[model samples]
Target: MLTSKTRLLSLDAFRGFTIAAMFLVNNPGDWGSLYPQLEHAAWSGWTFTDCIFPFFLFIVGVSLHLSLHRKVLADHSETQLLLQLLKRALWIFLIGLALNLIPNFDFQSVRIPGVLQRIALCTALAAPLVVYSSWRGQLLVIMALLAIYSFIMLAVQVPDVEGNLVAAALEPGRDAGAYIDRSVFGNHLWKQSRTWDPEGLLSTLPAVCSVLFGVLTGHWLSAKRDIAEKTVWLFIAGLACLAIGQILASWLMPVNKSLWTPSFAVFMTGWALIVFACFYWLLDASPAIHLKNRMIYLMHPFIMYGMNALFLFTLSGLIAKMLGFIHLPQTDGSQPSLHALLYAPIKALPVSAVNASLLFALLFNLTMLIIAWGMWKKRWFVKV
Candidate 1:
């Protein structure tokens, strides 16, 4: 039923590699990164950096397909399954909250609506929808979500505008997310200024569409069909999405992850599909390549994501804070970073930009990997 062909090593390897890349881009030796890939595109576009989150989300859909495809056992009940789903959602949401609580438990000023929280809600929403809804129904829901978000973005106006509020005047689009979130969560949420967060209430609806696309793909893959046929269909579907997304970008919305526009969702979903195809062909069909071994050895995504996720992120935030405040003596005078402390000294020898980042990222990930490997070996997953 579920997890046929031993969990498709390619998928695992791809997942592991992506998670590692997330760490690399996130924690560079310097914020003044020489590599363009290390930085996220400022706004209104996509980049390899942008692909990281969607890739993880898309793979989440793929993993769902592989994990839950089995026919119900004789003793299993839909009621029981539904309970499991709710429990899973609550568990995931709480884990995200736990991550937020780390280092300091600052609820009053703490920002909510984090990455894990989004994944939790998106996954929970998508799974049940996939389970109960027809593909057409799911498609309609996705369209409805995108349409609603667009309307809100374009048509919604900020109330209480006045001459006194200089910041609001400077940026009128402030508090869009906060207005909605405050109405809903009632101040128990992220306060990222007068306007709402880019990863706010509205963006998530379309983000879930990415997961739905994955579920649809998973369902397609799970169908009783020939491998060649499945691969062909997947490729065609990917191409269709890619084409439609590009066409819709101009008329409907721009490809912006910060905004999480519908066009960006479609584009990311399309690329995810294409990536899945390549993995299926090279890794699944040709076992001689031994890609799974690489993933198992060097990656093991769940171990990385589940364990180092909170730990790595916390470490990263602290590193930034330390670098931001702590000044260091420099040849010229003084710099406001510990990054230059290590970086400048290393330059006393010889190092390229990539080499510096690679060395730093490697050390960073190795530290994470060691922690991850400890948990992996112990079979202890810090699930959120």
Candidate 2:
């Protein structure tokens, strides 16, 4: 039921919205003290920052449903569907790798796992399952996958846990995930962790579950029901999912994204479903939504995603680095970084740190938006 124009446009807007948030939270003026909303929940809770990634994954599932359904309705050959899936997955995965090389290209130091790569793998795994099986089957698969991941992550002890099992036990409070990932990837792990990759192969199983939950929501949307009815069901479903996720998290697994716990998938998908219902009601069904149509301004988010997104994210980091490299001379001819210099006037006063960080993020995001606008003016959609 998605329109060629409207469907892609809505999806692009969703993608851009999430990516814009990514740039905002990531490039905050100071990480040490950020708005609690901007910081990812330390552990075992949700925050605004955590919503963005799951939202992206949910968007992926929404679009995938429309895409695969259209293929079926068109009577497309199975070969064609498979080919499209493979090509799209490869493209996303490769782009993630290519972006890892930006600001500096060092193969030895490059991260093996990243946002797009995780998306690519999750989509590849979820799509085939969604398209080939019934929605009930997909639901069962989601349950099984979550159960398996929970058991593997929380129950299975690392080989090296015992003193002579393989090596001395790690210090208390350490997770088994890091040890497992290190034993598997060793030196090929993420540079950030120096041992485990957050987007590692093992964690992606639950990532697939995230997509499966999205697919389940997609099925709910596709059901033969009026918009109001659909909205009501979606809200109910979201609440049910939240309850189930919390129950499972307490009993079987902890909701940790670094390990991609299945409970995290359920909880995030529940939130995404709730949001989709809100947007659908406001934008499509509400007669009083006078300015809702104006959201089309963000219709070309894919252009931002494919062309300027990585450029912009990397650029923000470079901007911070450049600020650090500044050597402004003080009255005593003492050198201070630009940020240090700027902080004197702002932080010296009693002001909310969040206000400053938000302003800086807004300015940078607007700059990225202008670049995206320029590309739009030229009809230049850079597809990956």
- Give all candidates' CA lDDT scores: 0.67, 0.69
lDDT by residue for model 2 over 158-224, one digit each (tens)? Answer: 6543323332222222345566666666665677556666677777887887777777777766666
Off by over 4 Å in 2: 2-10, 160-176, 287-291, 294-354
Worst 10 residues of 2 by lDDT: 164-173
Tell me the tens digit of each residue's lDDT in model 1 across 103-139.
Answer: 4677764656777678778888886775667778887
Q: How many residue pairs clash per model?
A: 3, 0
At residue 13, what lDDT does model 2 achieve?
Answer: 51
- In model 1, pairs of residues that clash are 174-195, 175-194, 175-195
RMSD of each: 4.9, 4.2
Residue 177 CA displacement from its true place in model 1, Å: 4.0
* Model 1 Cα shift for residue 181 (angstroms): 3.9
